[model samples]
Target: MTIFIQSFGYQLWNIITNGPEIPTKLVDGQRILNMNNEFTDHEYKLLQLNAKAKHFIFSNVDRIMVTYEGTNQVKDTKINRLVHDYELFTMLENENISSMYAHFNDIINALKGLGKVVTPRFR
Candidate 1:
């Protein structure tokens, strides 16, 4: 599992550096927003890719925490460490929930590309 997670991390880094296109959908209501600063095509693409990568990383970390094993071999201390890492990542990456939702679409696409076999636990 550690090896698999490392591989996923590497793939995610690649997706971040190389611009990946994520399809967008229109949401109901809300005001129409505009970008105040102009961006080149390449810069726009990079922004999209980074958004997607960040989204996937956040969601996956959450899922991993939800289903983390705390058995004999996997001690409670280990689980706590993993959860702490996830919380730290979330705090460092996301400023607010609104911005997180804004990038949801791109994150979904990135997850889809990663095979979409996440194990999420229900509370």
Candidate 2:
């Protein structure tokens, strides 16, 4: 889960700094993470986790709350919703930069919240 979140953050950073097209290289004449191609494995992993979380009732058992800071205010939200937001934004190919940045910031905040849940020192 952490890897998926970090990878998505990297891709989001690339898009914001460089453009919609992710900067990448050609490997064996095949393009990866380029303008024409995007990575979806992380997204798929998240989807699987989302499904399993529901199936096993893990989402309810765990208390992974995210402190979402919106444009005007801040509030608490469950990590499941943040995961849902991640799935939603990745599919929005035409989403504007500001919205993307908003989601990116929210995800960063979510990561910090998650760190608190995982590491006792953060708590």
Candidate 3:
């Protein structure tokens, strides 16, 4: 129980501070202001590569893109794993208001059977 609270608190802190930007996308780059007002050639190239790699990975990750029915436009979105987990927690809560450990175990086992990690309890 203590470990669970500690884990929840840590995740909550991350959500408050970093929010979603873990494997930061290209747009997640912060502008630089060097004292010399310029990036070294190597630094510039590294920045370019970072943007390219992030964009490639972002474009390729499945389920990372969401759209409404009968839509052809792709919208810009940030994928936050923590937020998704929180949503799952809400869903499970709605499913089992009794909040019994047995019910929790059933939920976790179902997910495990389907190759998903068990959703932890959090408020």
Top lDDT prediction, candidate number? 1
Task: Give per-residue CA lDDT, model 2, range 69-115, as digits (tens).
Answer: 34113323455566555555452588788887886777657856754
The CA lDDT of each predicted structure is 0.53, 0.49, 0.44
lDDT of 3 by residue, 55-97 (tens): 5435645533333321323211112333343345443434655
Compose the digit string of candidate 1's lDDT tens values, residues 60-118. Answer: 78665655643433454544544444333342263577776545544444444443423
Q: Judged by TM-score relative to the true structure, which candidate is superior, 1 or 2?
A: 1
Q: Which ten residues in a row have the lowest lDDT in candidate 3?
A: 69-78
How do all the candidates rank in terms of lDDT, highest first?
1, 2, 3
Our model 2 lands, by Cα RMSD against the true structure, at: 22.4
Model 3 residue runs over 4 Å out of place are 1-32, 35-37, 63-123
In model 2, which regions exceed 4 Å deviation? 1-77, 91-95, 116-123
